[model samples]
Target: MEKRNKILNIEQIHTYYGVSHVIQGLSMYIEEQETVSILGRNGVGKTTTLRSIMGLTPPQSGTINIDGIDTSRWQPHKISKIGVAYVPAERHIFPGLTVEENLKLAARPGNGKDAWTFERVCDHFPVLAERTNQDGATLSGGEQQMLAISRALISNPRIIIMDEPSQGLSPLLVQMITDVVLKFCIKSGITMLIVEQNYRMALKVATRHYLMDTKGEIVKVASTRELVDDPEIIQSHLSV
Candidate 1:
């Protein structure tokens, strides 16, 4: 059997916000080209997990290895330089910039190979091509989400971390975003760690699922097939 490369590894990370303790000794790993979803109720440190990995909120004690290099103490910009892209839930595109401009600003030849060009990203998201001149603030929520994902892709990241990609969208738009993500995963073969409250949509894109409890601990990790067949697991961990 061929060995799978571990692209991202988080082990025993403890993060805190001021005096409030969160993300108590959380550990997880994502293999290359794999899509893993972290599911939990709101405020279970789902967002914090991503933030910790990105160095936005550094963990006080833990090791984050990216491609076998320890990066727990690396700054967020340094992390990005190593081919890690983060798309937060807020979809923080430059509101005043044109859609094309936003993508241009984020374009980079990551790792000095397999760089994503403007044309390629536009091909991946044709809607973005049509709205090239539109201001980032003018696009609809779904469009803004696309732009955000596109901005990340333009960086040619090895792994993409997303927070609630499907939040606040209509069912049709959700399905559309899912399709885009699935296609991107299939084509690019880039690893992803997504934190989502939309269980159905997350399940659709992720091959593996990690269930987090209220205390920010990952209580279970299972294949998507297993989790989909077991609603009790979802109910026990995710239901209000």
Candidate 2:
């Protein structure tokens, strides 16, 4: 298959968390309409990498480019407005708000044809429509995850950075999440950069994969087929 246009490109980024250096010269790239997965064990700066892209954790050095624009100097909202959406694993929805309200709150103002509406999100996640009036807190873990993804989709982003989308869930829920991601990539044509520990699930949806070592460095990158066919690469870096 032909490669899509480059959507997000990170070059040698370095970050810190209160004097502790993290994300040392980490770089990655995602093409348009492609699903790219970042795989690594826990505490390896995978979340930090996503934070850096969202400008939540500003990098000390290096550049972040989204659709050829220099977003390294942009704020989180600015980056978001430029079509970069983030779905953090924490599921940042309002617990007090209803499901519909949570979706509405994320709706962008002055967005054009590509912007997502409540109906569109409901179409993708029929359960959200069924629970439109339910309080966000009452939803199950899977529902919360769906809401988080819907909230991001409501922004109509050109690219979405997802962190641990399948964490803390039942196997069935994980499969559902995986199916949703694949549908988004294959059907909706949405570009994505996902951080996941479930290598098998991730490989099922991703076209390419990157590996981050415990030291916050990119140790390897390859196609999904290569990563699956060669288990040694995973065992070497991802093994406990």
Model number with the top lDDT: 1
lDDT of 1 at 213: 86
Off by over 4 Å in 1: 110-114
- Clashes in model 1: which pairs? none
Best by TM-score: 1
Please report how far candidate 1 places residue 89 from its true position, in Å.
Answer: 0.1
After the best TM-score superposition of candidate 2, give how far the Cα of residue 82 lies from its true spot, in angstroms. 0.9
User: By TM-score, how accurate is candidate 2?
Assistant: 0.94
All candidates: TM-score = 0.96, 0.94
What is candidate 2's lDDT per residue for 2-56, written digit by digit as tens? 8767889999999999898989999999888888999999899999999999999
lDDT of 2 at 202: 82
